[model samples]
Target: MAGQAAQIEGIVVKSTGSWYTVFDPATGQRSRCRIRGVFRLRGSRTTNPVTVGDRVKAEIGADEGDNVITEILPRTNYIIRRASNLSKESHIIAANIDTAYLVATLDRPPTSTEFIDRFLVTAEAYHIPSVILLNKMDLFAGPEFREIIDELAGTYRNAGYEVLEISAKTGMGIDELRARMQNKTSLFTGNSGVGKSTLINAIEPGLDLKTGAISDYHHKGKHTTTFSEIFPLTGGGMLIDTPGIKGFGLVDIAPDELARYFPDLFRLAPHCQYYNCTHTHEPNCAVTAAVAAGEIAGSRYVSYLKMLEDDDKDGKYRK
Candidate 1:
């Protein structure tokens, strides 16, 4: 009885399938733990039963090596996407996030608008406030690139998202970004080459997270962050860094309700003739009218249509 383990409450800071690193706020100690058997049979459909940013209760063994997570506390919110193009299961990216920062790039392994929209849709569905961080501003010096950047910023801004044009390499918008991240749990995610890790390193220099180069042949970013992990910020918040994702498939969202997640489309849906306008072909659809009127960005509309059609085999919308 003297050696019996005691239960402790902590946050799951890192997850690598079989093992989790739980960080206790009270003791500032992290314990490597495995989940109890019942967790696997809890009827949850996600690929991982326990994900980073999850608050959990675990038993700290006397030897410390046999710690077992016993319970997952209720989450305030979480971002989820289909686990794979061919799989039905979902993958919870992170839970209890205060803000979701989607780092995007115009070129050097360009992050597609569809991918951006999809990620925003998921964030909207979960009621998580999202900020679009347009990284690599230093490279967009040419007139053509500048025009593209302006249009991209305007498109999302009009759709009601805060778009920050930042150069993680040059510290252009790092201060503002850091200010926004203060005292909040933020999730930094994006396509492989969008500089999520580099940006984080710029914000918290001490982290020095590993970064990768763009594939010259494909112009895509090589995966750098292998797993999801949460880090305490020197300023006043926590950050969850995840592996670069290639495709973000919508999970648990009905086709009919997809438009609600798109802020611009949702605002115009009320003016449509039909109560349940798919915004595809409904007569007098305000969404289509807005598109034709240039009130909504064509690129965003195209992304919506693609998601509605659900035809992309790998869930990666290509130009």
Candidate 2:
């Protein structure tokens, strides 16, 4: 047996860089540990070597100090993104997520539609069921605000997803959200300042996740929650709250295959000509035609193309 694999069995509840905080279920002890060098890089394109929600076997040191993670069990599914260093590599966000909650805000943070679409496409690529939660319903006091919410909720629902408008401040729609989350390990993700931490605090008060305000100058958000950490919900399931991600760099997905991630694009791509249409300039391209005829959102096709171009001509992602 490897020297590192001789200790305890536990689930990784937190991951920062290569350091993981694993909880030993048997003893209920959480130890901060580093993974074996074998797992470092090891051909993973992501910036992070390990991810939250990993099932790992940890070995506590002789002094009962910091432990070392010896092995990582297989994950059912994981969400990954491009590394932030602009190296064209990837980073594993979270693993073994039963469901993902796409939290967005209309008033304070104003989550972009392109961001939501890109995330949804990525979720589809990972085979994760995602539900959109438009937070801060209490702040949308005007009719115009309500109309936009309805339209967004309707758009996602029409795309074969479940969307709900909730007020983490006023407790609106929190019950339904809680019901759906019962007994499920859910991952909450969105742009910064979209009230992700606030909503989690409202739902599971004991979590006490740090929350930050949206930047008024850049009209963006600042990172409040640092590192990804999984918290056990008092109601039953687990919720993983990740740091506010400013950019969601997609990883590994090739350009030619990018359309497959978009449900609407995939549904209509088979009709294009040339059997392997790149959908750029190919004649009789159903995707291009759809774009021209307003069948597909131009923004989405552009985002797909961006992903493809970012993949480089080598047909792989690695900066």
Candidate 3:
């Protein structure tokens, strides 16, 4: 059957622009494949047509080195953000993730609430489970810093999210992270300098993914993990590692729907005076009242407003 096209099914483990590394399900063989010219992501304006964690069908010829990916199977879910180059378009980070672990840090390039909230909103929009991983806990040496970290952790945990305080350098709480990732395809994402790669190495040693130091001058993480790649966790799961994100602009979501993604806000939305309250200037707004009454975190309310600002007609936060 040399003349017959050798069709095979596999999952895309790595995406480096034009070439994709797909792993064979049956034989565990990896084939470097290129997308067929006519294939495109349906209803998507993303830069890359395919991303890591996507199941695909490819035709392997006599030389498996140059297989052509013919089709992408239906994805259960995918996480995306605004592409850096294209303002209107987006970039799919990873697909079919059972859980998205957001790695955050309190010092040496601290993670902001706006970034965390935007990410959580996106995850909420896609119905993907999100877990917050607070790395660099060892840096919380002083009682003041420890209080800040503990308060931040409490804020999220109260919002119905699972927050794990970890220090990859010291292996603190890495085991718990591993246990949570067991038998699940988890997407590890975070801002630069938040220790995403270091945590991965700690979770599964020898991978030694190239990691860079946080720039002391700028206090930001230097870009590492240039492309999206998936690694099989020794604990019977998959972890997709993504490049450090500087910003996570929401895409494919509308302004009116933003409040619904915030669980705490949504719960109080129905009690507002106006049925179509924007929660900004609307009188007797339950959301704002909750924010004032100390029932909701003021930082979260600010994040919601920032997203709303981006959705404004002349909003400048789109990027």
Candidate 2 stretches greater than 4 Å from native: 1-6, 41-44, 64-66, 312-319
TM-score of candidate 3 versus the correct structure, residues matched by position: 0.94
TM-score of 1: 0.94
lDDT of each prediction vs. the true structure? 0.88, 0.79, 0.87
- Tell me how far candidate 3 lies from the true structure as C-alpha RMSD in angstroms: 2.7
Q: Per-residue lDDT tens digits of candidate 3, residues 1-319?
A: 5656778899999999888999997999999998876666464577787889999999887776558998989999999888431388788899999999999988688889999999999999998999999888888866878778778988898788999888999999988888888889999999977888898899988899889998978888988778889989995998888899988889878888899999988889999999988788878999899999988899999999887876777653342
TM-score of each: 0.94, 0.88, 0.94
Model 1 agreement with the true structure over 126-187: per-residue lDDT tens digits = 99999999999899867878788889999999999999999999999999888888899999
Candidate 1 clashing pairs? Answer: none
Worst 10 residues of 3 by lDDT: 310-319
Q: How many residue-pair clashes does candidate 2 contain? A: 5
- On lDDT, the leading prediction is 1
Measured with C-alpha atoms, the lDDT of residue 267 in candidate 2 is 75
Off by over 4 Å in 1: 1-3, 311-319
| Tens digit per residue, CA lDDT, model 2, 175-205 | 7777777888999998888888888888887
